[model samples]
Target: MSAIPVKSKIPADQQLKISPFKEVIKPTVPHKHANYYELILLEQGGGYHQIDDHQYDVSPPTAYFLKPGQTHCWNFSCIPIGFVILFREELLTRECLDIVYHLPTTISLSNSPSLFELAKQFCQDYRIPASQGVLNTYLQLILLKMNEEMATPAPGHQLFSPVYYQFKALVNEHFLKIKKIQVYAKMLHLPPAQLTSICKTASGKTPGMLLNERIVLEAKTLLSNTHLSIKEITDALDFSDASNFVKFFKLYTNLTPGQYRELAFSRQQ
Candidate 1:
C-alpha cells in the first residue's frame, strides 16, 4: 500500500507553532502529520472534517486532537475562528503528553470560553518580543489548561505517577509485539505480581487489563480507520492468527472484528 502523504503547516525553525484559522473556502487535500501533534480549537464554523476514516462535523466550541501519522482533511462553508497548536514529540514527550494523546480526535469541548481565551493569549505571546522561556511557559500553560478540563471524571481519568506513566509509555511502543503483562513486567524490572499490584493500587485495574485494553484499542482503531483485512490486522497487531485475533477481540467487545468495522462504517454513512 502507498504511504499516506503527511505535511505540517508549521514553518521551519520552530518546533511549536500556533496558527489562526484563516478563511478556508476550499476543500483541503487528505494528508497526515509526521512526528508531531495537533490541537485545533474551533470557536465558530459549520462543515466537515475527516480524520483517518472517521468523519466528524465541524461545530463551534469544539476541538480536535491529531496524533502523529493520523490522516485527515477538512472542508468548511466559511473559515472557522480559532487557533491550531502544533508541536513535535521532541517538544512534548509521549509520557509528558499522555493527556493529549489519549483524548479522542474529535470532541465538543464543555469549556470553550476559557480555552478560547487562552488561545488568544497564546497568539498575543507569539508576536511579542519576550524571552523564549516566557513564550514556552505560555505554551505549557495552554496545554495544562486543556489537560485540566480533560481530567474530568466523565471519562474516569487516572492521575499518573512516574512509574505508571513510564509503563504506559513503554506499552504504547511495544504493545503490538509484546501483549503479555509478564514480559512488560520483566522489561520494567518488576515481577509480574508486583506489576499487577501496582496497576491495581494505582488505577484499580490489573496490568493484564491495561495491556489488553491497549491491544484491543489499537485493533479497534485500525479496524475502524483502515481497509486492512482481518488477517492483515491480525499480523499487524502480532496475534497468532486471524482466528485467534477474532476470538480475542470478540471476547472483549462481544463483536467480531468485521462486525465492528461494519458498524463503524455504518455510523459514518
Candidate 2:
C-alpha cells in the first residue's frame, strides 16, 4: 500500500493565492495540505466534497473551508466555477484567525451575494498581483462577512476568547507529542484551572477532551488514508505499544484501527 499524498498547490515563496477553481474530470484521490488554509467557493457545481470524515454536497453558491493537516477530496459531476483562495496562517490577523477557527467547515452562501462579489474581487486582485497588505485586507473582509452570514452561530461562538484560539493553535501544533493540559497551560503562562475554565467557556469542552479529539482525528486520517500498519501508526502517534493504541482508539470510536480502515476503504469503493 502507498502513503497518502500531500499536495501543495501554492508556490513555496508565495504566502497567498487566489484563482478560479479548475475543472475536475474525475474524482480526486484523498490528500492533505500542509501549513495553509484553503477557502473554496463554488458558484455552480454538482456532486460532493469529502473532508476528513464528513461528506458535504456541492450545492451552488456554497463555500468549504479546509484547514491544514485535514484530508479531503473532490468528486464533481460537472465543472465548478468559482474562486479558490489559499493562504498561509501568517497572512491572517488575530481577529481573522479567531473567525477562521470558528467558521463552520461548510457554509451556505445562497443569500450572500456580497460574498460572491468579494470572491470575484479577490480573483481580480490576485491577477493584478496586488500588494500583500492589500490582499490581506481583502482576506480579512471576506472572513468578517462570512462570519456575519452564518445562518446559525458556530458552537461556542459567543464565548470564544483570544486565549481559546491561542490554546487551539497550540493543541494543533503539539497534539502529536504533548497530551497533558498542564503542559499546555504552562506554555500559555496560565494555571491549569484557568486554562480549563477558558477552554470550557469557549468551547464547552475540557482541554483534555480537545487534545484527545485532535489525536483521534489524526489517527483516523492515517488509518483511513495511509498504508501504515497498526504498529507503525502507534509509534507515529507516540503510543507506548500497539495494544494501548488499540484500546485508546476503541475507547473514543468504539472501533479498532483496522476496522475503521476497512470501513473507510469500503465506502470509497
Candidate 3:
C-alpha cells in the first residue's frame, strides 16, 4: 500500500494522526491543540519542549504523550526529525488508549528506556513505505509496550492512581451533561471533595480544571471544524447562552469565540 496521504482535515474515523516534518520547520510558540491526543517519536537533535507547565529536554528516542488541551511548544527546539500521531480518545479500543492514559502523559525519555526504544523503532517504521504493512505492526507494538508499563507496580500512592484515569474516562463520556464536579463525584460514588483530591494527586489538576479543559477543547473543535456560530457552540457545550460561552472560552484561552474562530480559520487560508 502507498503511504496514506497526509490529510487536510482531521477525520473522526481514524484513531491516529501520523506524519513527518522535515526541512527546518519553525513552528509557533507554545500552544495546545485542543481535543486531540498526541504521541511524538523524536529521531534526531535536541531542544526544550514544554508539556503543560513541565518543560523537558527533547532528544533522540524521546516520546511524549500530550493529552487534550495541554499547552506545548516545539519552537524551543529547532527542526527535530520525528513522526507525530494525534488521535482522538475514542478512536482506540478502550483498552488501548486507556493503557496510554495510565502513563504519566508528560513523560521524560530518560525515565523509560523501553518506551523510548519502542518509539524510535516506530518512527523508523513509519518512514518506511506505507505499503510495507509495517505501520500497523509497529503501532501495535508501541501500544503493547504501554500496556506492559501500566501493569507494573510502583511505589506508594501510585497504585490507586488508576481511579483518576477512570474519572477522566467518565468525564469524557459525560462532559456535555454533567458539567458540575459534584455530578461526577456522585456518578463515581465519591464525595466531590474527595474526587477533586484524587484528580489532583493523579493528574496534578483539579476536577473542575479537567472538566473545563474537555469542554473548552470540544468547543474549539466545533468552532473550527463546523459552520456553527457562537450560539450553536454555546448550546453544544451546554452553556447557558452565547455570552456565557464566550466568557468561558476567554477565561481559559484568552480568546473569545469569534476571535478563536477567526484565528483558526485564518490558519487554513
Candidate number achieving the greatest lDDT relative to the actual structure: 2
TM-score of 3: 0.52
Which candidate model has the greater lDDT, 1 or 3? 1
* After superposition, candidate 1 runs with Cα above 4 Å error: 2-15, 21-37, 48-57, 65-78, 88-117, 124-130, 144-160
lDDT for model 3 comes to: 0.66
Task: Mark the 10 consecutive residues where model 1 has the least summed lDDT.
Answer: 151-160
lDDT of 1 by residue, 155-231 (tens): 33455444665577678668878878888888889988888778787778887788888788777767766788888
- Candidate 1 lands at a TM-score of 0.72
Rank order by lDDT, top first? 2, 1, 3
Among these predicted structures, which one has the highest TM-score? 2
* Candidate 2: Cα lDDT at 82: 88
lDDT of 2 by residue, 213-247 (tens): 88888889888778899988998899999999999
Stretches > 4 Å off in candidate 3: 1-9, 23-25, 91-95, 106-137, 146-163, 169-179, 185-269
Clashes by residue pair, model 3: 1-131
**lDDT by residue for model 3 (18-79), tens:** 66645374754445565567777666656666554345776665667876645555553566
Model 2 residue 38 CA deviation (Å) reads: 1.1
